[model samples]
Target chain A: MKKIQILGTGCPKCRKLTELAEKAADELGIAYELIKVTELDEIMRFGVMMTPGLAVDGEVKAAGRIPDVEEIKKMIA
Target chain B: MAECCGGGNRLVYACSGGADVGEIADRVARKLVKTGFARPSCLAGVGGHVPGFVASATGDVVNIVIDGCSVACALKTLEQVGADMTHFVLTDMGLKKGRTPVEDAVIDRIAETIRIKSSGRVEESPASTHDGCACGGC
Candidate 1:
């Protein structure tokens, strides 16, 4: 199963990104697990200097902002 | 993040920063809950090291992390707690980080993304019980 993680605090953009991710995954018909990372210490461990990041299979792909759906599909695909 | 069952009860957390993208993420999360896509979870609880919150986050449901920028503060939080997440970033969506104008079209696009993602999952049942934590005060 593919693991999808959304990293951020409980903010607006973070939540929006979460929704987009779900859509992309469903559209692709891939089974994925989604997790939210909201702690400061935990967030820092990923070496992310910003809020709202993206991690796939334990790897940080995007950080500091929300990505487009097409880009998200590419990341998950 | 609180874990329930299926995407209906899936937890969503955002960076909630003071920037434009942050606001967008926050708004999107609210819209997702209103539209019955996923249940809004507490990001602070996970950040504050609340045991119950952490325990709830561990399970079979989807946990979403949304961030406004590349700092990925929210993503790091979950990682620190040893929890996995399906992450998204606004900057990656072609939205510039930092101060920017919030547009309705942008918000609509974000909402559409969420709807598309949750299309095949269990639709949030109308009879589904609401814990009333959408405000994250729990």
Candidate 2:
């Protein structure tokens, strides 16, 4: 299963990104676990200073923004 | 921040980009509001030159601009519309730029930092609201 984590402080954009990620993953028929990261120390551990970021399978794939649906699909695939 | 009285309310606008830092900033803001630490304001309204948003951004209510990168999209948007705000930048918070893995612990740390800086309060653990997707019609 693919482990997908949305790194952020649970803001609106973060929620939107999570929604987009879930949709993309489901549509692609990918088995993934989505986690929301809302703490500060944990976020800094990833060396990320921005919210609404994405980590795929323990690797930081995107940071500081929400990726478009097509791009997210490609990332998971 | 004071509650939205009359036609104006305090708000927070995050530059939620495609990168990890951007995502983190966006999520932190939402979580803060949901948890009662802050309120999610209107970014589009400020960007669109809405008078209500602009007026609320001023005065006593706190207008926070959280930006994922130094590009400062959120701050710029508020600035363009003459909205005064307190700002936080992920890059300035000491997170290195570039693609990095997203970790729950890291996010916690970011939220904690904001909590400390803004009001010296740590966030309580989030409740098990739901595990379904936001698009699941919840």
B31 in model 1: Cα distance from truth in Å?
0.9
lDDT of 2 by residue, B1-138 (tens): 111111112245788877888888888777666654554556766576543344335423456678889999999988885656778998898776576455667677877777556652213332212321111011
The parts of candidate 1 lying over 4 Å away from their true place are A1-77, B1-7, B118-138
Which has the greatest lDDT?
A: 1
lDDT of 2 by residue, A6-73 (tens): 86666566688899999999999988999987664575455443345677886666654567888899
The 10-residue segment with the lowest total lDDT in model 2 chain B: B1-10
Candidate 1 per-residue C-alpha lDDT over B45-68 given as tens digits, one digit per residue, 9 for 90 to 100 = 778765435544543345677888
**Deviation from native of the Cα of residue B94 in model 1, angstroms:** 1.5
Isolated chain B TM-score per model: 0.77, 0.72
Question: Which 10 successive residues of model 1 chain A have the least lDDT summed?
Answer: A43-52
| Best-fitting candidate, scored by DockQ | 1
